[model samples]
Target: MNQLRDPCRSAGRTERGRTRARNEDAFLDCPQHGCWAVADGMGGHRAGDVASQWVISSLAALPRQSNFDQRLKAVRHCLRILDSRLGRALPLNASAPYAIMGSTVVALLLEGNRAACIWAGDSRCYLWRGQRLYQLSRDHSLQQQLMDTQRLTRQQAQSHPAARSLTRALGGRQPLMLEVLELCTRPGDVFLLCSDGLYQGLGLDALGRALSRGAPGQVVDRLFTEVLRGPAADDLTAVVVQP
Candidate 1:
């Protein structure tokens, strides 16, 4: 007989940070559902927080599925519907360069030993194993495009004025293109889902050290403490999962 790994254990939190007027970030931490997500909203007065909250709320409402594939499909389906719905709600006369209401999402789904990551925009998912941390999601931003196509280093890409701009997101003028990555989880593996605010404020080394020595809750606390030590100019959110 084979031994089966236990389901995931998770913890999550969000903050307005020291500079943001409002925290336009939200998270879903459901170990029971084997689903976790972090959403970062984008927009102005229309309410970025609302958009992010809506994203997390919708994911939270998903019905439990019996298999990993079914749950993966359900999450993808939910984001697609949201993209259409949010796009339709945009003003017909909205023009270029205007801020559009939308949210960046990164979600993780776990079942037995399988895990899947679904995302749009720049929110991220990371895996921590064997004392090392690995980023599992790619950014959908101009900076990344420059790095990919022009072979520019991250520092060079950052020099571009619009490098931080998102190239894909829910409710943008163009249709959303979600990315998916599937992989098998090992026993005692740790996964982290976070908004840009959290990742940007802390380096990979800090993140790995935090994940190396604690439970989900302790790691989350360490992450927040480290980020808050800095300016934390934007809203921050993080979810840590271990199995």
Candidate 2:
């Protein structure tokens, strides 16, 4: 990966919107460790908040290590352990059968010239570099699946009946299949990690203007302002990192 000279800045936020009784979203803003994440609990499931909290808390307690690759491995191991715990709890929840509490996760790890993004479900990662914005992660939803198979075009997926249905999530009955991407980093690059609630009504032009601003905090504020202008159907969360 190419290296750049500028130092990094970071900030994040999460809010319970107008409708939800409780916020089921969680985030990790660890600029010191170059790690950030956003997780959204499945709203229809009971105790979904518990599942989202469990994952973020685990990530927060991750052992500090100097090696970047080792840190990624540690994160993978942590999730695998979480997967086991949730699997074991399924039967117990089923008999007393707690409703299936699951969550979607998107994590960003930056180390010098290298940037790594890992995720499941619809949580997203976006990059703003050289005055342009690009999505770094893809959605793991039913509509996205249809697009992948060529059954639906990009425009078709937008209005599809299952547009918002998730196909993968942490703590689900199916085994987790984590998707990861590693790329070279550039100076003055800004990364945005957010949950579905923050982007549903957001426009690309507004996002670009905000991301091009001077500070990470202001970018987040602008995002919240734009998102809250319309109906906020769920919890909103976003973490902005500039490196």
Candidate 3:
């Protein structure tokens, strides 16, 4: 059996982008805790930024444990607290279209050779190796639901007007149904945790190319540069990790 390697170089950045009045994206890069995450808030100005910040803070406070199961439990605890906290801060009104204060969170927890991905809403995690990039987490969004039901192809769903609408999130009306996936790792493997905004304008191929361009720090810089050249549809955030 192969042994697991610790996370090496890592870099992350969050930008308000060209259009947004305020950035609602937040991230964590705590290698010592073996946790990294990205959160993108939604529901306009009700409390998007606050929700996103809580997502990051909650995960960051989780006890550092090597056991995957315990770590998962810790993550769950934070999410519930986030729900309760934000739920109270932003009262939900049935009549309002965007009433709940919530955010999408995607997290990567690494222990030994294994990686556990946890997520809610549409924020995502991706792996890059051998010049190919693989999206590790699936979006919990209307677009994804349409694809799952075979009502729309992946490409079609991406372009659909409702693509940005999330089907699930931390403080939404529905109980949070977080998703998790565990995977083995390699030495050269690179992982990315990002908000949907970072990917909205970036083509998948371009993203892969940027990941392959250089070291972790270089790759992060390159990704932002690429996004800057294009029209930013939302606030952008990218967290790059290597192990």
Best by TM-score: 1
Candidate 2 per-residue lDDT, tens place, 1-243, comes to 222234368889999978899999999998777789999988888677888898899999997766778778888788777766765555654456645668889998888788889998899999999999999999999888889887788789878887888888887777888889999998778999999998876887887888998688989999999999899878999999988
> Each candidate's root-mean-square deviation in Å?
2.7, 3.0, 2.9
Q: Which ranges of candidate 2 are over 4 A from the true structure?
A: 1-7, 90-98
Instruction: Output the lDDT of residue 150, model 3.
Output: 74
**TM-score list, all predictions:** 0.94, 0.92, 0.91
Residues 1-243, candidate 1: write the lDDT tens digits. Answer: 222245577899998967778899999998878889999998353567888888999999998876788889999999989888777665665464454678899999887878899999999999998888899999999999999999999999999999989988887768779999999988769999999999999999999988887889999999999999999988889999997
**Residue pairs in steric clash, candidate 1?**
none
Off by over 4 Å in 1: 1-7, 43-45, 94-99
Candidates sorted by lDDT, descending order? 1, 2, 3
TM-score between candidate 1 and the true structure: 0.94
Question: What is the C-alpha local distance difference test score of candidate 2?
Answer: 0.85
Candidate 3 CA-lDDT value = 0.83
| Best-first order by TM-score | 1, 2, 3
Model 1 scores worst on lDDT over the 10 consecutive residues at 1-10
Residue 213 of model 2 has an lDDT of 85
lDDT of 3 by residue, 170-243 (tens): 88867778888988988778999988778876889988988875777898889899888888768999999987
Point out where model 3 deviates above 4 Å. 1-7, 43-45, 93-98
